[model samples]
Target: MKDVSGLLERTAQSQGAQPRCPLTGTLMTRGLTVPMDWRRPVTSRERQIWWNADHSFGQIHPRPALDEIPEFYDFPTYYTHDDPNSLDSAEEERRIGALGRLLGSIAYRFERGAEPTVEWWGSVIPRGARNGLEIGCGNGDRMKTFGAHVEATVGIEPDQRAAAVAREKGLEVHAGTAEDLPPAIRARKYDAIVFSHVLEHTMDPILALQNARDLLTDTGILSVEVPNNASTGSRWMGERWRWLDTPRHLNFFTPDSLRACAQSAGLTVRAVLFRGYVRQFMPDWILDEARITAAQQRRAVTQADIDRQVRHSARLLAATAMAAPEKKYDSVRLICTR
Candidate 1:
């Protein structure tokens, strides 16, 4: 593991005085202006077709090819929530499907080779907590894990299919967004609320936090994990950064900005730890870029091609680990108290 304490101190010292939003008093950071057709719904059928065509191995969907979309200083990191083109269930399914396909492919590669290990943010959950809620809980793997410790665990997932899977696992899951959480659930308080890799998708992170706060006990903890926009990998990959899943990942945050957003929502930051090295993403990036190159040349991408790329990626990861063991990580895990 990297020296988390040292990284935290350096991040604080480098950020200096944190900037706040004028209206909401939220911490402000640079925003990307990538205009998305939030109204454009990519259906499950569409995603299936794309995957069947092997597009999942490459850029399955077109994205804005710019460094920064345009910067806006505001409370809501994203502005198109209420727009006619904003995301809906069908559209969200499409987005999730694409992501699932990409992750599945990565898993396939890992199963065949030296699988990369990640220190899951789920470990932040307090052992003594009795009950907890996971916002945007996906298929509820984390909820299942938490349920083992906590007496009762509830999950709020937007994907119906995924929710079904969670229910089959005997998890208490509700199908919907946090904004529209069931009143029965909303009335209950939790010892901890988890927002693992979910906040970046929200248009109003502050509001999301505020809603989460309402569901937590006075002393409850909010554990959040998000991709670090200011990571070395982000800078190195530029537009091709795998984490830059535009439209889906609307808000890019640094530790300072994330703390600002959490504080604005009536939460006190307890700790901000930059966690997990992303040696795998480097190879994923190379493969994605290579696919584009191959497409332009009217060449077919083969399994041999993918195997070669994966081998190269493994070598690159080894080199980076050997040379710079203390390199900056690609994600930030924040623990906040209400």
Candidate 2:
């Protein structure tokens, strides 16, 4: 591990002094040097990830100052800016293949108990919530999902371009970080506030949580979901894990760290749930790995590709069920009340 330690020391010197954990002020360690992922290369900024001593949390060292973060969000390819309305419905349906949709519909009947990503998110908003806010609500997707339950849905997006798209959808979006809220948002109390994978992007998650708590009414729900740093994915893949999309993802949280961070923000942790291993996550890994293994990889979808995908995905399903159950999955979701 001498090489690793030397790398961390060199990284520290280049970045100018080590960075402490944003939430706890603990010294960070386990410096992992990684290249930007093939899919989400937000910036060319060289970064090293450092985990807190307890291994419960990790973050990019030399964390970009709040204002400097915009440079990393190279807008066009950045997914948060995807305006749903701009998508052509014909092309969208084509993307979701006809045969796949037919099979999925049939399977969906048998899998009625399965929670859709949107429904799972909507479940956390307190019953009778009149107004709800989604921090970092990109294109207002989840906001639209929860709008049925709540009378009104609002969003806070740091990227002005993304916020403009959400606003075009008639969503009341504030283009600012939760750590520093606009007066309009600070003036009102919400019945529910959702982070939904947004907290990790903030400069100070604890401060963001506190601000969210303060924005809540007497009875409110605060829902948060972040990549589980201690998940089977992270444990198995280490620095190679897909979720460690650093520079974009500043904070890495495990279940315990998330709970502690939430409590530190002065919110009551009602329940914590771990989900999204086999269903939401593993398929991509399975398909990608399978593609690399097969000699006859094809650019165009074919019956052979379908058969291969199904076979590989089934094996992973069985493996995940046996090996990484519940709390060991990819995401950590929490429901908090105030």
Candidate 3:
């Protein structure tokens, strides 16, 4: 494998150059061309899904079933169990909750190590503006960190259980999506609106951005962080890319595509920065590829397979860390103004 750190630095240096769109073969000036026929329907016995191989976009079947929202907290297969109406036994729920916490802790440790402050808003956050909002504030840890810099912080979460957890931590969390902000929240303007790893899950990202724009003050900033589809990790992993968690992540955005999307929604991009998440991606890729290969062979994933990938991933993580610079990143964070 190429040194992850060296690859990242090379990628960063070429950020200004335009790359050809994989689908259209056109030199992408702003965004890649998304063909109407690019969607390939994926059929399963239970449900239908679609994937745009060219643009890296995934969509769930049963098309416009608006009320179907999956319960994100339900355990071992956190997001894999996609039945929106499925319920678990009390014991199962407890196990699932514990697993969720454990995974969240691991992710938090990695993220905090990558960005100690966890506030990548840059100069977009104006001085003396102490109010902020976070969309899809899962578990509220990031919101807690934001609280350190702001006097007042609130969050909009669609998951009822997750919202309750955030409320328990004394956060002013509303149990809903950003599309319809409660009247009280809508009445107040904010210095910043954060969509940390949330926009990709939204059904309509552009509309979500427009709605978020409405709640912002004239000088308020919108800080978005999403997995970069144009990253070296995506190029290397192809179909096994960790970020392509389908039925959940609806849209994949590269920096250029995201900037164009933001501009289309009437937000002006100010700055774009990347954050390295090789630790997360490399291990996930190993695990997912193993699971996929096992499924293809009509067999269950074994402990031995899991252990082997885990061991290999550990080595890759160590190498990546050693090669990576203190400031190099994998995820793209964009700061925009309305």
* C-alpha root-mean-square deviation, each candidate: 13.7, 7.5, 11.6
| RMSD in angstroms between candidate 3 and the native structure over all alpha carbons | 11.6
lDDT of 1 by residue, 5-104 (tens): 3423432342334333322434444323222222122211111000111111111122222222222211132322112323454543343344323443
Model 1 misplaced stretches (Cα beyond 4 Å): 1-127, 278-327
Each candidate's lDDT (Cα)?
A: 0.53, 0.66, 0.57
Which portions of model 3 miss their true places by more than 4 Å? 1-64, 71-124, 281-289, 292-298, 303-329
Instruction: State which candidate has the highest TM-score.
Output: 2
Off by over 4 Å in 2: 1-16, 37-43, 83-123, 279-318, 323-328
TM-score for each model = 0.59, 0.75, 0.65
lDDT of 1 at 96: 32
Candidate 3: tens digits of C-alpha lDDT, residues 1-338: 11123323433432334433323344433322221111111221222233344444333332323354453233433432233423344432343344322432343345533342535334356777778999898778778776666669999887766676678889898876655556666768888888988887775566678778877788888888887776555554444445655545556777766776688678889877667554453334455655643543456667566555555445444444433322224567778888
What is the number of backbone collisions in each predicted candidate, taken in the order shown? 4, 0, 5
Better candidate number, 2 or 3, judged by lDDT: 2
Top-scoring candidate (lDDT): 2
